[model samples]
Target: RVRFRDPAGATRTGEWTDAIECDGRSYDPAAVEVLPPCEPTKVVCVGRNYVAHADERGADVPDRPLLFLKPPNAVAGHGATVTLPTGVAGNRIEHEVELGAVVGERCRDVDPAEATGVLAGYTVVNDLSNRDDQRRETNWVRGKAFDGAAPMGPVLATPEEVPDDATVECRVDGEIRQRASREQMVFSVPELVSEVSRFLTLEPGDVIATGTPEGVGPVKDGDRLELTVDGVGTLQHTVRA
Candidate 1:
């Protein structure tokens, strides 16, 4: 389900049937461009927050959260075509699909027990990366924060609607590449929020990509990438060279 404005600018909420008519009104989804569901101050991401993901990369599981930031320039809406920077040699772009937690209010040093109260909703995000640039530089800002690197939304799901143990999956060109249960997370969402809150203040709409599961791989031009959260929704993007 989605809450959006019609081309006429009237706000409405209902099932996203992807059809021309919604609630007795005929409108084309393609004609009325859907914007990113949230406007975040920053997009914070967790690294190796999943045990299987850490193990797959031969990296030690962190005792605490490994946090990273993807600049606002990276944000993109559903149906966007992510461009490959021509200057970067051996671009080796890859997708790290994960569940995105959207903050609902300003918070600092929040109690983990009350973390859920600050969440606006959850959505899907494809954490696009330049693996070659990442492997060559210690800092991944240049690798992960490129324009259109993060494709999010289609819609947002309330926290109450998403179970803690929801399934997250990624598919490339219709083939499943990564799959796991949220229960495999090394740090739960509340714990992650609390950990991040210890240092950075989270405002309404600030997003946290709760890391990815195993099976991350490279994507090439013309590939279709889809990130799906069991209770959230699928966010799809096209790769462009």
Candidate 2:
């Protein structure tokens, strides 16, 4: 359920019981160093995948999946600090919690029916956005894809762990902000994988961010973001000015 660094600083794998067991040893979770569950080659994210999110943004629903990318450098581990870029406090840097599908095997031109077969597991992703740059520039490099923009982990769940429709939620300092079920997504995981693979190849350890629900708003420095995907564990991060 979790992969972490032991007190000795060696990487180990284990499942969550009441406590975590790794290297055939059980230890208090608070003593372990939690790492980002996956080292993705690339992070492939969808946009406006939820109908209500699209409606909130005053954008039309897309007939097909709208894809974007965040480089591997953007990933931050669980309990990490997400540094907000300077001068965006009033400009609207926001947090989006989404279901992240981790690719298991390399494949191309895979059908929707076979998409889940290529998945290694699922995790929670905080899709942080800088709205000012996003709206001012056509390319999202500065707006959506930036260092530490994607804080993930806490745990990576096997496909069997997630139900047909997992509920996703985002909270700021213990208050709920975003909430939705996977069923609310305009496109399903199968469709996204099938369609994305049609254009590019997917390799092992690549992450697909399924997108977030409505209720996305601004997050300030010192704000604590907790994103949960029900079956998948919660990812916690603090914003730093």
Candidate 3:
């Protein structure tokens, strides 16, 4: 599904195929301003859910999922230009391509076997990071939860559309920076969802970001980033210094 601004400046949600279909009229996707497919109350992110990513940071992967939170204010839509914090010297802002799971309802203590039943769909999320602040702060609130920190959407695909081992990747200015299969995640989507629900009730529209693979790096001003998740489609955004 796609959420976009219609020609009349109204926000609309529609099914996306060769074109966007809504109310019996097809729309050229490029002609409309794409919005974040869902308005997440909170974005729960997994850290080091990939072995190679943990190795890159020289940190030990936890037996259980390592999690972080990015509040609603951090959410940004496709085609948005995210501003990097430049107050600190040597600030290293980076892009982390991730697959996002949108919750379908409010629930707690979900069983892994039944996790899929609570999912609305899947979408692409760029977990924007301020490495300089992240390395210093324990909670990473300043590092990960800044305004427009999570660039998401363009499409939300149902569970049936995405394969179990779909590819997720990030390209900066047309260069492939990160690429891996969803199967590479140390914790699967269902496992992550179940674990998170065990800690807090996941309300509908909340998103679970399943973590990034290796090759995460910086994005400078004027850089165009394309984050893609197989079956969901690509999320494009730019960075501003």
Candidate 4:
């Protein structure tokens, strides 16, 4: 099932019947325009949520979740092109596909068991990065806070439809780059929700990026990205100047 939030601020939920309709024509899911299901107040991300991913990048594992934020202006639709800024020279951009959680209700200091209840649904997220810039500054904001860096969607899937333990995989040009079950997460969805809620109040439409697995690398102009979560759907996009 595909759940989408219309531009009018109303929610429109639909199933993948024959094809997705837009502008009076049918197109593949990847070709459709998308919108953020929620006008998020903040985009919270968990760093090193996956063990292998942390080790691959030569980063130490954290005892607790590591958090960061991406500005709201950085968000864009799934099919949107992410422009590389001229100011950041010699920077390599990487793609990190994550399973994003959408909060349904206001919550703070929520318990793990109750975390799942607060989730409105799930969506695909591509956390783009400037690796060289990141290493140079040792700060993530400049590396990740680029316009169109977070290309998310096709639509959202309610928890009732997509189980909490879905499989997430990311492919580039039809080659599998990252694969893992939700069960493999060092921190489960509910646990992450509970942990983040303790520090800040999660309001309706707020998003939490659960984190990406290993196999993350760089993508160049003209490269294609295909991110899929079983039972949810696939989101495809191309890199461009």
Predicted structure with the largest TM-score when compared to the true one? 3
- Cα lDDT, all candidates: 0.85, 0.89, 0.93, 0.79
Please list all clashing residue pairs in model 2, or write none if there are none: none
Question: For every model shown, what is its TM-score relative to the native structure?
Answer: 0.91, 0.96, 0.97, 0.87
The stretch of ten residues in a row with the least summed lDDT in candidate 3 is: 83-92
Q: How would you order the candidates by lDDT, starting with the best?
A: 3, 2, 1, 4
For 80-198, candidate 3 gives per-residue lDDT tens digits of 99988768446788899999999999999999999999999999999999998888889898899988899999788998998999999999999999999999999999999999999
lDDT of 4 by residue, 80-187 (tens): 677865567575888898898989899899999888899888888888887888777756777888787777775778787666678788898999999987777788
Which is better, 2 or 3, measured by TM-score? 3
Query: Could you give me the TM-score of model 2 versus the true structure?
Result: 0.96
Q: Which portions of model 4 miss their true places by more than 4 Å?
A: 1-16, 20-32
Quote model 3's TM-score: 0.97
- What is candidate 2's lDDT per residue for 1-241, written digit by digit as tens? 6878888898887887779887678988888877888888889999999999999999988888999999998898888898888765356898999999988999899899999999998999999999988988888988988889888888889999998778999999999999889989999998998888898799887899998899999988799999999788889989987
Tens digits of lDDT, candidate 1, 1-241: 4545677787665556666356777666676656567878899999998888898889999999999998788888877788876777686888998899999999999899999888998999899889888878888977888898888987889898788889999999999999998889999999989999999999888999999999999999899988899888788889888
What is the Å distance of residue 99 in model 2 from its true position? 0.4
By summed lDDT, the worst window of 10 consecutive residues in model 2 runs over: 82-91
Q: Per the 3 Å backbone cut-off, how many clashing residue pairs does candidate 2 have?
A: 0
Show where candidate 2 strays beyond 4 Å: none
